[model samples]
Target chain A: MLGDNDGILSGAHFLDGDHACAEGAIAAGCNFVAGYPITPSTEVVERLAWRFPGTGGTFIQMEDEIASSIAIQGAVWAGAKAMTVSSGPGISLMLEHIGLAAMTEVPCVFVNVQRGGPSTGLPTLPAQADMMQARWGSHGDYEVIALVPNSPQECFDLIIHAFNLSEQYRVPVLFMMDEVIGHMTEKVVVPPRDQIKITPRRYTKLPPGEYEPYRAGDDLVPDFAKAGDGHRFHITGLTHNEKGYPVMNAECQEQLVCRLVDKIRTNVEQISFFHEDGLEDADVVVITYGISSRVTMRAIREARKKGVKVGHLRLVVVWPFPEEYIRRLAKQIEAFVVPEINLGQVVLEVERCAAGTCDVISIQHAGGAVHKPRTIYDAIVEAVR
Target chain B: MSMTPAVENPVEQLLRSERMPHIWCPGCGIGTTVNCFARAVEECVSDLDNLIIVSGIGCTGRVAGYLELDSFHTTHGRAIPFATGLKLANPKLKVVVYSGDGDLIAIGGNHFIHAARRNADITVICVNNFNYAMTGGQIGPTTPLDAVGTTSPYGVCERPFNLPFLAESCGAVYVARWTAYHVRQMTRAMCEALNKRGFSFVEVITPCPTLYERRNRLGSGLDRMQWFKENSVIKNGVDTRECDIALRQKIVCGKFVDVDRPSLLEMVEAKMASVLHRRRWERMSREQQKPIAMRPMKG
Candidate 1:
């Protein structure tokens, strides 16, 4: 289906990643947003605050990150496409609610404009350190889709995909943007409303009495019923059965948790998005995501200039970590070099996938800044040697 | 054999009886409060489908699950903010936050005070059993002085919150206090709160028989109810500042604050309407003959 015309800007305009994200969410029919102001990520909510009222949307500045996180789920249950935005510290505070969103299968977006942090280390600086935390920070086992957009234009484009994937899978989709990308200004072309495709929420066609909220179809995704729909459905953080009633047993847990993980894990081919280059005849592949992916481009150029056969693979969807693709490439390539702002997070995944088939080289940074192209170029040269 | 039809309970329509027997223990006063809440729903809410019950993690948080409504049992201390989101998003749903004192006032204290200050349109029913009853009676924000619990075995030394006072000071439009012993009055207060348009709070003092009553040697749940019957003072217009509960002391309970004000959503809507109107007027003036300096007149 086409996006609503009211939300489409439909023109060329200079926009930062944060503002582009707001416009993207609006274009995706996001009617509600609850957020707390944090550096780098605060502009997303600010733009929404200024723009939502005009578009017949609701934007609330919640009390804290925790409130901001859970409030979006509430809005989701109330039959709106909702989201919350924060930085690392705020995302840390929001982890519990992320788990809640996962447990109850609430379709919502959580935007984290990445910052350098173990705890408030550098609020206004860029880092890709949260790559692992976005997948595993929330307690218990569940799957979520995470997207990384390197430019302002992709930020405008991919956030709409983020919302659609969330609605399709009934899972929390993470919009992972670094401070550099979030703050970078560029011209973003928003197409006409009819040109933009949107995935409408899968509301059940079953009658209220016939609907069992947790009963999944063959696709392993259940239909959704909104509040005040006379469904009178109950959802909880506890392990529940098909009727959405709490059932405290291992069998119920196994059934529910396994499906939660399998829905995205089995659909990785459909959900995974990446940009590949020069893999046809390259001895070495440089794998990266987020801002690091952009830096990898510069390093790859330098490596090519040095007469080294270096391939580039940029992860657009980071979580559900492109393991199968990496494994296939690991066999074909001699080595894989990973350059990230963090100290060897995504490198671990590369090493696990490479699994002795190829040597994995990690160019680590403790992250107040991005990796210099020189460092990555050296890593690429060493990997091929 | 002669056939006899089953006589359904009066409030059975509002409950998920298939999920029963409930988890609340014998002699637990939480069920009594639920009865009053059910009665209030029966009397006040005409559109049952539009009512949403949200609760945080605790003994009282189970209220959402047992009620046959569009309900959510959310994370600990988060029911208010969740309800705030629900109410703001739809504006037609009558949202309610039902949880324990520890869930609403301690871990959720920041959200509680802020939601009241914002005047979000939701009703908060905080079941105060003097401690964290769900977690085996740990010390909590509402645990009275000298109360003995697992965490406060030596006796609670810190000052506890006067919840009615806290609610009133934080700008709750409707504030009331009632005990499980005062079911009729509690039901009336819940009805009033349900009908109110802004943030409304009702603090129900109930007995946590397994942990609070046994640990404090308060005999049993029946004895606690007897104590409430004798000690509770009915003061309808009394100041909220005097409604604090102490160790085995006279409990003052009543309706304290009731006022009318525009809610958070209402204020947001009005502001947005005015801004959009002014912008539209400005756009018209710029395209027509009016000067750019001219402003729209205030009502």
Candidate 2:
């Protein structure tokens, strides 16, 4: 039976992305999950419910997304690797707690299975419209790590990475999975527990009375202490001091919100990850992420056959924006083409990072489905023009 | 704190006195209730670190902020779910949800019944001041019928919820009620709730001196307390259905429900443990065999 130690399947399985994501979290030592079932995301919790008992984990079907979001944070503070999963409408309701998670610096994970939305736009349908929301959905000046997975295997791999990054930064890492990746079934090979490396929660070594919950060292990230661990501290949604007590003053607000944003921003090099193909000598580059990257791959290959010197840059970590790489690449590339399931979301980031150094072309899709190869091929053709 | 300190500081030890004197209004029952809560914790638990207080948004939600223990002042209408996570994640910790009627029952009512129905192992201290006290005396879920509120200036038209009935029907293992004036009883109830093993609820009718009391012309907080002393009846183990409070009417307060039912965690682990063990054994057997499988798929 799985204990506090090992629960990894350590074998290849033909699993849907949602199931693979669940195994990834379990393998990453996630033992507490509170979630509400929303389409394209329910399978993750369903599997956890089936697996948590002997696996030394807990799965709760909360009242709603708001409760689910805060519940995971509660679990996180109680010293469990915790997570919650939902699609667009549910994600909307969770926004407030997500902000609270940011404010309190609670290390947790949120899986957003991207669906078309203004409000419940399409439950089972695919969309990348939530890309911007993943960064700014919560009201406040805060940043979170967001990862996009294209296949079931990447879903397995990246969810673990998301947990690691979350623990390392003490931020709620957003696992931004689109409907296609979430519902897609493919082979995912989860390695042995010993082979997998995880970022354990950095518990404070300071004695109980000496410990301060929000006090950080030079890394700008503080170690955590669980509620019952004899470290008496307070956590609140309001702006707080280093001792974790709410202080409603401008100085405290500046001190707190700055660290929340800078913790991720300064460590962008450590957190930012992407896959680059044929970029060293290319004139035009095609950038994509999530399922959109897989769709754009066909267009890139087709464009290559026609002698277009267009390269591919697929983002595994979508925010902290990967600004440095985009800026540096923008200096050399003649143009950049971005195609996503949304009308246009990440393209705005690409254009912003490109900073008019080169032309940035956007291929828009309405998001009920993936883009046609011909359309992306045509966008690539136009970007290099 | 005042320029002149009070003769006796009952909550000095448990309250974050540096962050205080709290925002509770003059002659408010909230401060008195908080004092009782602190005293209850002091009596119940030898070790204070394991006690966690979580509160939602509102005047009563501010209770978590004043407590010196490990506390979480969470989002409005979310204290119970958050405490549910806290308790399940670490069973050793004693989790408590403290919030107001508006925050817990009006917007957050669904979670209240569900948590009680699931019999989540946590104590809930719901402070009912009759109206939405924080938002300036708006009609609330527990607002007595025909009472005056800012939003219901002509007197409230709707029937109020009998919180004890709601809690009892939803499967709480222990349920009780007391007015803020009943300090000793309220403190004892909290102590009992802290010791209870399953979902326990204690409803305290406190005076919202600035809002509920003033709008209803209930005179001062002192007057409200005096009225409670006159009108309240202690009916321990009474039928919850008849305990509802009405305007200028008899206020029935008591321990309404105390029974046995497995908590959500207990029920889940009990049902799933054996099946989970079989699967774990199967995984172990698989590990005893060939190499871990590997495959590559379309990307």
Candidate 3:
């Protein structure tokens, strides 16, 4: 328990998105952070380094992103709230351990501040190209939670949401921010300590000898025991049985991997967060998220002036993709205008959900900058025609 | 052979015996290293509850799976950083990283050096079996020069890493080396390293009888053990630079370095003490301050 303002800023302050993310981690009771300094995201840990010691938190600058990622998982298993922040290049190096966390059901946070990339793309700019990678980067069949914040305000609020989801579901929560949002400064009102809610670690009640480390209970999540609590259980990256022993057989893989996936798939509605505006009697809808959504706002208003009847669907929780809502809305709307700072990453989802029922217009930008309202406005006008 | 009395396992409490029979083969030196490690943990660490073992991927990495203490078999070459996290998160826990040569030296070498450079409060026990035995006898970072392996069938022309030298160079506070045949000495070294304050390293020259020995024509595990017994020079306090293993050469083994140094946790705590004290003072003074914490556990 944070017993004081040690973890909360608790007032309105003009700060950048990266600083807000740091505050969010502390407010969520995250006490351990291991990260390599990275552009657009380095400020997150810099802020943490200055603030953590006072809050009894530990910040380790690891040798590389690979080490940083696994280090956080280690802290998570030891009963500490932990996270890592990085950009595209670091995120690429961290893909393997992200799968390990998902496979092992370790609760932690990964904040990737999106920058341009095929390789070391743009250090100081923005891109949403990693949307697909966030869903399927690690080589495996599993699901993870990812949250996208549209502004500095949301970065503070939703990172707390990210940590809570991670704690409850026992999965890695990806806090997907972009350079545009990360460096953007705005007024963020942090709630008072008691007013904020946090999801505490669910430690198991079974006596040491009787407890099975990986056995799923009613909520489809197994209760955890911290490393030093005398429940000297074995945890591995290998596909394991309920006892957490490596079981190389297919049956164990089927059961374990399925649960890793279904736990998120089955809870899609609870995990899904999106915003809708002007949906009533609209013939066309514009779908976007992160900084792109902010840029699309002006486009939506302009299209309304042209009487395009265009609605806006802003995705707050990007992963688990809001399929059910989009699928239902696809039938009623004539077209879905998608604008993103990448080459049509999330728009593919819109196209899939629409499934030949409606026209999907993708307005793509190749990184280094956010989308312009005119580009999105043009797509809206074309989709309506 | 009958001189030693047969007895029940003394360190049985420290083993997850149900997970046995283990995946180890007869005469494989990994079992010997594991046994010595268990004995050291049994004899040295005062708090069994606080002791944890972290292993990386390899044949030797399997050691964590059988340990009764909280253990993690992490991804290849990652045990050091993972253990560093565990130690930093809860300073009360005694973190020990047990991994193999290829995992700890080749791929995870960066982490190994950095942890040592920072004097992280952890012990690293490296089992050097000459080659990557689990992956069918491939040449490893510690493979002896001119020794044959699956990948180096023509006899390895590449230079082998002097592990003790590397550890010493990386600023490890305690460094030692021993063959699996020297069980008593190995166990004693493990205990000493366990008791050390900062980064300590123990290199066990174990035989991979199944793969390494068969490929290199080193006869049986018995012959390898007999050869090491005859060839090893226990030169205590010898310089680590001369400890490198060449093909069928006299292997120098001993505790090379032992000194006191501040650990990563200590340094970090010292650096942050003032800031933390200030926050505590602010907390005590503030009338409206409340702890930002998660909800309490439900009964």
Candidate 4:
């Protein structure tokens, strides 16, 4: 489906990642945004506050990140395409609602412009430490889609995909942006409304009496029914049956949780997205995402000049982890060198996927700054050795 | 079974009948409050389809689950903000937050104050059972000083909050307090709150027989209701600051604050309209008065 034309900024402009993200959400038909100001992420909401009114959307600066996070979920249930934005400490406060969104299958977006953390370590500097936290921050067994954007353009482009994924899967989609990508300025070309593909919400077609809120079709995602649609549906954070009533038994828990996980796990092939270069004959693969992916390119160029058979695999959709693809690549490659802003997060996943079939070298950084290309170059060299 | 045409309960239509018998314990006043709420919903809300009940995690929070209207059982202390979002996202829907004292006044205190401050269009029904009965009667923000709970076995040293005072001071458009025993007055208060335009709060003081009553040796839920009936002073329009209830003290209950105020959405729309209008007028004037070269460059 085409997006609302009023929301589409169909022109080329120099924009920061944060402003681009705000435009992306508007273009994606997001009608509600609730956020609390946090450094590096405040610009996204600020732009939304300025633009939403003109686009017939609602923007609310909530009291705190906790309120901002759950407010978006409430808006989602009220039949709006909704989202919230925050940085590390704010996202930390939003963890509980992230679990709520997962359990209740509330389709919403959570944008985390990553900053150095371990308790507000660096408010204005870059880090990809939240890569692991995005997948596991919320408690219990559940699955969510996390997209990593490397540049200002990708920030605009990928956030739309994030909303679509969340709506299509009825899950909270995390758009992970680091401080550099969030603050960096570059040209962003927003396509026309008709040219942009948007996934409309899969609202249930069944009558009020027949519709079961949790009942899924062949896609394993239940069609949504909003609050005032006369469905009179009940949504709870507790383990529930198809009737949306709390069913406190192991059978129900196993069924609900497995479906919550399997819906994404089984459809990983369709959900996984990555950009690869020279992987056909390369001996070593460089695995990275977000800002590190941008840094990895420089290191890869230098390594290629040094006669190393190195390839770059940039992850766009980080969660659901592209396990099968990684496993297959592990069998073909000598080693996978993973460099990220974090100490060693996504590298753990690479190591697990490799399963000792091939070497997995982690290039760790203590955040506050992006990799010095030479650091990743050294890891690429060591992996080849 | 006497089957001379089974007479149905009128309130059953507003409740999830199959989900009952409810989880509320015997002699618990939460059930009584729910009944009063149902009556209020029936009285005030013309369109049942547009009513949404949101509750946080607590015994009273289960009100959302029991109610047949579109409902949400949210995380602990988050019902207010969640309801605020619902109301703002779709102005047609009448959102309500029903939860316990500990859920609303303690962990969710910030959200509570902010929502009231914004005058978000939603009705808040807080069931104050004095302690956290669901967690085995732990001392809470509203637990009376010198009262005994599992967490306050040595007697509570901290002063309990005057919920009506908090609601009024925080800018709630309608603020009222009632005991579970005062079903008629409580129902009327709920009806008024449900019909109010902005943030409205109704605090219902109820007995927790299993945990609170047992731990404090306060006889039973019936005895507590009897006490409420005997001790509650109906002081309409009294200052909320003078309505504090210490242990075994006279509970001042009535409609305290009722005033008109623009809701959060109302203010947002007004501000947006004025700013956008000014911007459009400025742009038009600039286009007419200045040449294209002299105009400010678009970013």
Candidate 5:
């Protein structure tokens, strides 16, 4: 019953991890949510179903991950900020369509609250196994924005950021959260409607006579024409010119591919959102994200207290990764400690970004549990000191 | 009294003429499927504003290239998911997914079953050309067993998928099969399916002229049409057992199932009601959480 007129301090209450995510997405101005219930992420849909309508939005429980992903894509095309949350199996099912969204340059959000498995490994359990898949899950070399969230508040804030990035780049943004953060109940403060920043769809508010769907300019993002806008525009996953027509020529294919890739790559600075702590004169930097980052942060704090020179760099955006920052830190640091729920995913990114400057170490785990601060603390002490 | 000036059709009148019709080959079954779709569009609720046509990569997928509506031609076998997105985005739109046999059953098989299971409100018009006509007649999932094609040099070992049966099994509310020769029946089936409430599938067993016919010695496109006309039998009433027998003998080509299921959007909204209610009840007495001094943001 919260209204736009109600000038109330709408803050966070103690809720399960998934519900917090739902609330976060709602507050982030997500107007459409399409998903199927899978473990670790089901509560997200459950929370969204109720919250979406009151905001004059829609929530759809699609037949499967494929349908859910498609529905979200459609909702976004209609000029609404839309999202879908899923897990491992669901993500696998959506890989093909995710590629389509990428190729079509459709702005949408896909939340993969990771669960264990190549196929339905552990529905109720937590695992970060989809980290690699999130970046390279879909076939082909395409640029995708993936954000990793560690806590309930982040679940809310980054969803808004995710929506903004999707709109800005006109590409699907993957919000990769693990089952732990998805299920962990935490108190989060949602800002007032006026206080919260929102990115509306980049629409062509022109007369029907002057509309070109894939009209290119300095910005690779197409001018979106929502369904009710009366503008006739074509959208397809084919290799097309700026006019959105299927072009069979190699030159056209090259141009289209470059635009799709360059749109994200060139805008890396705008996409980068991270937190750095105690990097000055520190020998070891704890590089982590998602649920693992939370533990790594605590471990950094504990190690610092013990006079071990260890810092933490928590990445909010996992794709179009903060390579420059990591590269800069690599020169100063002796070792980069990357702790993740999976065996080793982001470590490779850190290693590549860091190159041979620092010893990139992976503190990995993949049983339905969070990496303890002690495990991270041991890595820091062993690597740096 | 003046008639309610028809909602001033805000969108451009999706003129069929906008689609210059010469692209398709002469005597092509794709033209028929496209015609059925065009006619079905008229039969569908006349909210052209919300009507979206999604097609996949195929000769039939080219349907989107010519259609004068809100159209999307997605990747191979990915039209179902793409249309699912469009349908979920705005439930107001009457979404129709047009794809070929290879596009629908082979690459897009997962999306197909799931869309049916979800009972997504989108209508799927699968033109079963049996062969991958666009890519030089590769053996598709719906390619008949022992049938010859470009990839299957000698013969195909895999049995063709019973598309209607598969749709019904996957939980589609309305499922039907018709050959290209069954022009009236196919168009009518498409119209009814388009007008239906939940996930509806109309599988048109269309002929492939260039590769499929040439390789299989099915003569010309006209000859293939005659084969369909002579082979297919219309069954108005029948049990599952009898239908299966007829299908096995390649005789029956009719609407197999028509039943309502909880559409994806409806089910989602209902579940959303409960989640929202529970959230409201809990949030009534409490406050939302403020951001911490330092933590990673979750999206």
Candidate 6:
């Protein structure tokens, strides 16, 4: 099925979307993957389990989501680019560790192939309800990078990008996918090892005595050292100084908290990635992400053919909000329509980024159903009128 | 800030400067528990560089931060899973986990049973101090039924967990328990668990000085240690059924289960070997080593 297009197949055959993500991780130099079998996302771990051994990587089906999440963190700390994939209920169990990774600034990838949930609402269905939770789930204030993909090909590309951004920023980059994209079957051309960019976390070659684990120079990201690299340094969830020792004082807490939040917020422009179309003469812009964006794109094109001035903005990087693109569009567009499968997750973000320039509205549907193109097309037509 | 005292043995040095001054309070049993871990590592693991220590959030969770080997101070109730990952990633590395009562039994209960069922090659050192120490002595899963704590002002109503019994029932290869007062025995137990090749669990009945002491009116560290010494009985070939009854009434301390089982690493290697053998028929010799060709991208 995988006929060559623009690159060497890298011995990667055309598989389902889940297998593409697994192969993408391997191409990104991931040496370890841990997961528990939750539907929709289970195939991700299964494929990794079958392929990793041949690739000289390790795969483990952990007992639950909590263990699977932590195991990946441990492997990453041991100097491997590691990952874990899970669904809604499992992702709920992993939130605490996700916050820990944010606090400790561990470079790891969390692939959340989302299913409908207030609590396991639809185990095998698709919903983007976790868009807000992925950004601000854990307690306390911190910045995390999350990327959404609209297709099986983007799933492969974005997974590699997620690992790269995680290593480059020293933050846990989340790969957000709904069940639709995660389970979809499509042909993806995976480039060879040389062409695919691999970014490992920065390692300190200095002696063990001189290495400071959490030394935030100017980047606010800590210097990481792997276990067998012979560097000995402490890492804790408690507020600590640059050397990674625990500091119980409030001043240390404030300094650490401020820097952690500011690092990603300040560098959001470089961190945010998305695409915009037909903005110059568009009356209404449809803002969407993940698999929902695919439907919205179709709706926008359909409305445009009917003499409506419709445009589309698909977010590849969901967190960091794509504020600059939205701000630039705010001056030209009359109405911003956000169509999501959740109640009101990303619309709030669009509204805030709009900054009172236009009428920001949401076309929302919940409980495991797709956002049909007609509903979104009607919203675009009304907004254009 | 002063320099730590020196000791001759590396294990002793590990206990002194490497593991202490611990974050535990003056009379807390966590320090002694960590001391035993240091001794165990020195005795069992020949290469300290190959040792990986993983811990969860709590007073007892701080054990990883003090260890001489590479350690991970993870989130609450997730230490076992983290250690599971560390071991599977590199089967050459020896992984051990240290977690508190609340961390392992309550929040991490799912991981605990699952790790046991999978039979991963990891040693778990669970310090049961009877209450949540770092969280200001809340009633924990290991807290005695009538025990007083910050949350259990009128005494804890729920039944406490029998940790060793749970480990044994869930198929841990080695299951043992020792109080902090029995330092030598605890260290020996830890060393034995570390040496065993499958999922091992060692529960140490540690003392909580700050909140646990104030609420229970245990008076001091000496009084609690004395109580543990008098009440708990050390036995061999202990059954999980009998242990649960003892847990209801008294403290049960013993080497409950020690049997061999196939570890997760062993199973993975076997599977890989089979798959590799199937592909061996089409293998090429070392003489042929040509670089493959690639296609160009449009972008």
Q: All predictions: root-mean-square deviation over Cα?
A: 6.0, 7.5, 5.3, 7.2, 9.1, 7.4
Question: For residues B1-299, could you state the per-residue lDDT of candidate 3 as single tens digits?
Answer: 46777788988988899999999878899989988988887677667877889999989999999999999999999999999998877777888999999999999999999999999989999999988877888998889988999998899888989988999998899999999899998998998888887899999998888998888888799999999999999999998989989988889999999988888866765665554566664553352222111121122
- Per-model TM-score (chain A alone): 0.98, 0.98, 0.98, 0.98, 0.95, 0.95
- Output the better candidate (4/5) by lDDT: 4
Q: Which stretches of candidate 5 lie over 4 Å from their true place?
A: A1-9, A53-56, A116-125, A366-368, A382-385, B1-27, B39-49, B75-78, B105-120, B138-146, B149-178, B181-201, B226-299
- Candidate 6: list runs displaced more than 4 Å: A1-15, B1-12, B15-21, B153-159, B209-219, B227-232, B238-241, B244-254, B278-299
Q: Score the docking of each candidate (DockQ).
A: 0.52, 0.50, 0.57, 0.48, 0.33, 0.40
Residue B45's lDDT in candidate 1 = 77
CAPRI class of candidate 1: medium
Q: Write the per-residue lDDT of candidate 6 for residues B1-299, one digit (tens) a residue.
A: 99888756645545326345666788889878877778666666666666778888888888877766677787878888878876765666777888888999999898899889888888999988888888888998878778888888999888878888888888899998888998978888888888777799999987776888777777678888988888887777778666652222466778888898878766665666666644531241121121111122112
List candidate 2 segments past 4 Å from native. A1-5, B1-11, B273-299
Q: Estimate each model's TM-score.
A: 0.96, 0.94, 0.95, 0.95, 0.83, 0.89
Worst 10-residue lDDT window, candidate 4 chain B:
B289-298
Better of 2 and 5 by TM-score: 2
**Shift in Å, residue A302, candidate 1:** 2.0
* Model 3 stretches with alpha carbons more than 4 Å out: A1-4, B1-6, B274-299
Error of 2 at B58 (Å): 1.4
Choose 1 or 5, whichever is better by lDDT. 1
- Which model scores highest in lDDT? 1
Off by over 4 Å in 1: A1-5, B1-7, B278-299
The stretch of ten residues in a row with the least summed lDDT in candidate 1 chain B is B290-299
- Tell me the whole-model lDDT of each prediction, alpha carbons only: 0.90, 0.87, 0.89, 0.90, 0.77, 0.80
C-alpha DockQ for predicted model 2: 0.50
